[model samples]
Target: MRIPVPHWPSVAGRARADAGPLLLAAVVVAVVTLLAGAVPPLVSATADAAVRDAVRGSGADLQVHARMEADDGPGGSRARHPRLAEDVDDFRTRATDELGPGLRAVLRPPVATVISPTLKITDGSVLRTFQLAYLARDGGPAVSWIAGGPPEPTASETAQVPYGAPPWPVQVGLSEADAAALQLRPGARIPLADDQGNVKKAQVSGIFRPQDSADPAWRLVPALLSPVAGADGTGGTRFAGLLSRESLPDARLAFGQDELRRTVRFTPEPARLTWDAVPSVIAKVVALKAASGSSGARDGSLKWETGLDGVLRNVSAQVGAAFAQASVLLLTLLAVAVLVLLLAADLLVRRRAGALAAARQRGMSLPVIGGELLLESAVMALLATAAGLGLALAVAPGVSWQWTAPVVVTAVAAGPAFGTLTAARATRDRRVPANRSARRWLRNTARLRRAAVEAGVLLAATGAAVALYQRGVGGGVLPASAPALCAIAGALLLARALPVGTRLVLRRLLRSRRPLAVFGAARAAAASARVLPLLVLVTAAALASYALTLGAALGHATALGHATALGHATALGHATALGHATALGHATALGHATVDSPLASGLLRLTWVAAVTLPVLGLLGLALGTAAGAPERWQTLTRLRTLGLRPREARWVAAGELLPPVALAAVGGPLLGVLLARLTFGSLALPLLTGADFTPAPPWWALGLVAAVLLAAVAVVVPVESALRRRRRLSEVLRAGDT
Candidate 1:
């Protein structure tokens, strides 16, 4: 028996029929996508987590320390590289000879080193090394601290710094509460003599607060080993350190320097880098050494090459390859799904002979049927496109995702329109005797909706969601989100509503000229039954994600501006040059945090922050064009739509720029920042690529022209063809009815 979908023609019922179920479904899908999946990754990344745990014994994996003055520059200012301190002779043998294969052992060559600055001590008169300490006898003014076994000046210049003596060498934490005998803040300056028993001044750099981290708490008071200042006023005490992967100190040290490379091991396995990749890094460092070569370099210079634990390039490439394969497989899946939907639509349309005949007998216009059918095709295509996007969003954060939504939406939507046209080509015959086949299809509508039709819809949509989620969860592409479950349930209900949906819409919107629409509607309803909900849910997912992403970007930028400096750029510099490029992204030179409690925030200014205005403007222009293609296309469509005069369309399209203006002027730059931050995960910006500062102003104009021209050509050329074809159809059909 043919299924006749019930129509609710009353304005209220029709309204409900048209939009009711979809509204409910969107909420459900959102909820499901969230609760069923999200929150785990969020928890993992928060509250100070480590990707790898400690190797569980009281031994160090890698130790870090300053290279001696002869290798790096004197007094803790020079660069240093990490070297494996573990009796390399033994490990070297294990790697080359014994690592033959009893077990698959992987030792990735370490790439960079942590430079630990050193402190030297010298006194005022005898200006020896920085050694001043205290010795307590029968209380001859109570000897306080000892540096190299005697007392010394607590500060270099008395009135220069408002703050007292700078921090001491390796502090043995002392608290006044712990020792009520040492009533210690200001009046407790320890006196020193230059081997002449004369009083020399000494004040506390720290009176250990039990809570203060400065207190190492082993009891002996820390002595100021050197002068309070480095004489150059650089905060040689706190703001001194560099962590680099490729660059290193000039020479290797004796066995005592073992605690310098913090041995961090990757369990799933750290990828091994080849010796070849290090040459470029080695070259860059060599050039810097040459360009900024210190005359003091006559003492020594760095000479290095890639070793087992020195470069990560080879491992980085292998990981990228894995990601690339996953991307290819995903794209292939999308293309196959779109093709399947089109094929199904084609077969379904071919089978509906009576619907076409009835449409013709009723004198229902061709374009109306065509338009409605085409629109349904659009709906199908849109839904799938949306689903793909939904999948991407649902997968982002834990996984890297890249795509412009409108592009994906258009691709998916076009598939259906093309499919509809293909189906329409077969529906040319529109005359047939009305019989029980058409009448019966119009009769069993209720059961068709509740039973066979909805069953297939729910089954397919739910199955896809489950399968995708299972794969994602297991593979760790997507953590879990509450919205995921909502998305799935919403998709199911949307399908349940599809068979009767178009009929309800036509009954409400089509006047007398819609019989062909009605008949075509019946045919479209059943043919697309299994797929509708999935499509809608997917569409909602994509669009919702876009909205959420924009919000997230804005929020992130606001956060950076608030938490850090106003001129701060959020992108981390994986390499020195990349760090400089990231700085160029801003409009002006800004302060580097230089010191923060968190190591990530304490950055040394490598170069003066400067503008790359022309590049930035051009990039902005190109970005606008790329990001707003839909708006551009709409403007062009308005310029040449059938119903409107050119001026009228122009007015409508121009009005859209208002919101854009408002956003540019008053909208937070956070969205852009968030988007930029997201780029980090995808390996879109390499460590080296961020260094180009050659300003190209005129180049930006050329980019704008190219974008406008290309966008115009792609949109206009096809539209012109469509307009001419639509005009020709009008004359032929009286022609065909239209939207």
Candidate 2:
């Protein structure tokens, strides 16, 4: 004979039977996990792009300049002269060696120059000081000859001055523009005298112009390409006369050992500079500065200076601020997710109450019941978490464990924790006591607990606000939870206010002759006790409104031609009038930080992900929150209908229950969102992230539209839920109520 088979249901079968609540919880967990994986990497990438843009815009400021006196006392107390091309090559090797591999890739080849002190030019009737500059042609900016050719060494034997000048006069070249302005021509001999009455002669060899004026190589000696007016507070202009490497020997004598300054300038390679390399580059720069500084006194030996470290530090600070702000958004989403999970758990427990109660009657232990429920919750959490993480990795690749861990832990724990709590409460005794004093005592205890929780939330919000205010955005990096704390506190406060407003409406309905309105108001007043749903709705509404407002602002910021909208109209017109080359240079410089640039585009992309995702999540969460109460609401409505209430009257009661709080959320959400945005924007450096001059502010119409849409959505959900609830038979309703 064959053994009879047992009929036991699978966990999947049970989950499918109660899919409504489980499905919602699963979605919440998965989305939160996905965000945990996706958001940080996107924020980091955007921040890196911003860092690159800042470093690129810094231009010549990122250059490291090391100055060493060409003539110093030798081993024995003599003025020492630096070797012409040899010193240049030696410095480059030293720079690369000091920086090592950390900064070597970003470091451009060093350009060497020998500069002379201010000397009176005695060639023209106009008085002027000309600085005799000899830039080694190797690795220098490209140039085109306008007249004559590059400067050459003098051939005269007597031309060699006391320092190390050639035997003849030093020959120099000037820019074509400088030549025309100074009324000097090639082959003209000009006499120059120093403050110490040391006279030297210089012959103009050829006039030249830079192929690319914006080339940073020209920035090494700025005055070489352009005439500097009133350089010494005198009426005369200042000019730099360029000489070839061959003229360095003659130039050394022309300026004297005391006045001769040799500089090795290293400009950064823009393409090689990136966010990850910033810290290493900064450390190397500091090390180089220290090594170069310790050589001797400030002006005695080689001294190095650069603004690169400062620039990188600034970018780091900005990234920190942006990350801190993003943390607030993440935390807010997490808080909303937790609240939604709690609501789902509440609904799930209520839905299973009949079966759970029957099991208890059959002597099933509370621990056994809770364990089974927990196992189911754990299974759901695990599956959702895995799917979410897989999706996040697929989208963004990297997982920031610090950010993801909290979300994972919360997701795994929230469902089971809430389920056990609800089950424990459900299995408690339900017999009513005859004494009013005991009931009064219970009410007092509940009031005390609520008061304590509210006080704790207020205290936490205050502490976070104080800390954030003290730190400010530029002060340094901040804890991510500060804004979230403040937002939760604000939402709680609004939630508390909602009940009072509903009570007032209830009182008015009490006075009114309309029975439907009175019944509806009574239903709304009862719902005040269920603060979790209200809190979730209020917070979600605020976030949704905030997202919309931010999206609109971003849209305006990234709108086409926005980069050129500011004063560029005239600039563009002027560029056209000036010439193609002039216009192109101006456009290139002006558009360096525009919205169309990679920096702004990256920022927009990251923010748009948030801007688009939040509103959709908020709406779905609101739907889940609303649906969580549907079973109980339908049970109550069914009983009222059996008690001779018309179907229309039942619908009115449901509307009453939903409309008051939903209307409150709609009105209060935008206001709260605006307040939250205002409070956090300064600390977040929002303008820096957007690359906009002003912070974004949503107009009244936008705020109003958000409120109206939320109200409309709730209004629509009311009838849909009512129609869905009406589908159940009376027998099913009575059985559910009994359970």
Candidate 3:
């Protein structure tokens, strides 16, 4: 069945008249689709980067280090220590063979020594003694140098010193602090004595600086030895230095072979790899361990260590958990969007009901009418989906196909299906009894059915909440359905109670002598049509209030964590400066500093932004829902105006009609939201608030803001709509007769 071409123009005109509500329905689809398409990939990328940063900063990736173990004879007598270089070489080869291409970079430091040496100053006064370590590898110091650049090569490949320095007879580098302490520059000769009493005259070749002393990377760099003038009563400052491979024989000779061998060991430090590469590296490590043996011991019975596997697993779990939480939010937003769209579509259908009934009277079948409405809805859905996709692309350029495809399907299907269903349900014909009473519309069976449906939804939501609580206890991602189901059940229950409560309050007001009070009560008693809009408004308010409360609480906890970490660092710094034998104390302090870094802060901000923005969208939908009912309201006020009600009095009556529901929602919605949030917090056992003394504060200011905006909307829309109707004159409205 086709819509006749001659009648197509008439149908199109009717559609145009319903354009306002239709557009609102389209906007809801667009917003939901955009959020669904954009959030996942962005969240994944952020999580991956954060994991990578943490892994790199902590030096937790795959590492191979050699240690000497004494071999025992058959009777348990100690035989000999394992050969260092040979064992390390065998382990490196086996690890490389096992990891293959997955291995990033391997670092091997040649044999060296950390020795306390005294610098003989030009003024014949020694600057005191400090510890200096020398590296015999070219790239070893390059990894940790923060100043004066890395050492440059000499004419021969055997030696490297500071950039632009002439070849020293015996090359040595000093840390920046050491260079300043001895007032020594490159090319200056210094006589150094090791603990073994050997003296070597060496030229200061370069000055290099290590990273922050607390950084794990600082341990990787050789420091320059230096002595402080006024020490903190223990001794002078100790710094490390790096030297080329050519300088190794001198170090061995000065410090002795046994001492050097005991002090220095070869270790492989994995270079920084991309976050995506982490899983493959972890897999390789696992395979290497499995292939090795039951003990999984490396050469020389050395222990192989890598925290990359655990870090990656934890990060992946965290990403999954965060996405799960976000999914609950998305589901909630989608539910609200669908509700708003259906309400708007129903309103549009009712506005066009007269035209539809007239068409039926002229012999148009229901199927043809339904088909036309469905086609219109499909077009709108497609257009809105296109707009939403474009917006999603603009907002998150790196969004993957995995995120976009499902959302697109949901966007395209949901809008048209809801629109068509609403139109069909609203346009259905039912014969009216000649003497039908209002009491018949309020039948006990109808109330019971509605109550039963709400009860079923509430029971399902309760079951989901219980499941979510169990999942939280077991420690994994919480299902999105938990909170979403709760919100939906709460909204349904609120819808059931609100109209009855409002009627009771207005019935009491009807006895008052105030003209506006009586008029508003009478209007509200007859305004059953406004129930869905009130429901939508209250739900939006509740969700927004909950989000704001959660965001503020989490934000406070995050700030506290950051401050606590900083305080620990400060105390550690003070202890180190006091010359206490407390390197272990410094490590403990530094460990606390990693709890709340910039990456975690960024994630919190993203969460808060999303939380706040979602409610704002809901409020927009609520405003549109309110505006859709304006024409009927304007006609009612215009009729009252014709009965000698002043224009100002009519405006007052309109305000009175709108304010009661808005006020009730403003008070009740946030309270319900807070209750829901508290239940969610208990069930989820969210880590954000764990170990912190924080209480969820109700967002009273946010509630007030929502209330103010809604009241302002009523004031503006009602007055503007009424004035427009009055300007058209009473005769015209009567002639048009609600068409």
| Winner by lDDT | 2
TM agreement with the true structure for every prediction: 0.29, 0.78, 0.74
* Model 2 pairs in collision: 156-167, 156-168, 159-167, 160-166, 166-250
Each prediction's whole-model lDDT (CA)? 0.29, 0.67, 0.56
TM-score comparison, 1 vs 3, better candidate:
3
Please write out the lDDT profile of model 3 over residues 577-692, one tens digit for every residue. 54432443443333323423433454455556655655666566556655665666667777887899998898887776776666656766677778877877654433532224
Q: CA lDDT of 688 in candidate 1? A: 18
Ten-residue stretch with the least lDDT total in model 2: 2-11
Off by over 4 Å in 2: 1-10, 61-83, 95-105, 116-133, 136-167, 171-245, 276-300, 359-375, 394-397, 425-434, 473-480, 497-512, 545-615, 677-698, 735-739
lDDT of 2 at 600: 42
lDDT of 3 at 410: 44
Worst 10 residues of 1 by lDDT: 602-611
How many steric overlaps are in each model, in order?
A: 72, 5, 6
Q: Candidate 1 overall Cα lDDT vs. reference? A: 0.29
By lDDT rank, best first, the candidates go: 2, 3, 1
**Candidate 2, 138-227: lDDT as tens digits:** 555777888988887665423323434332368889998778877789998767777776677888899999888987667666678988
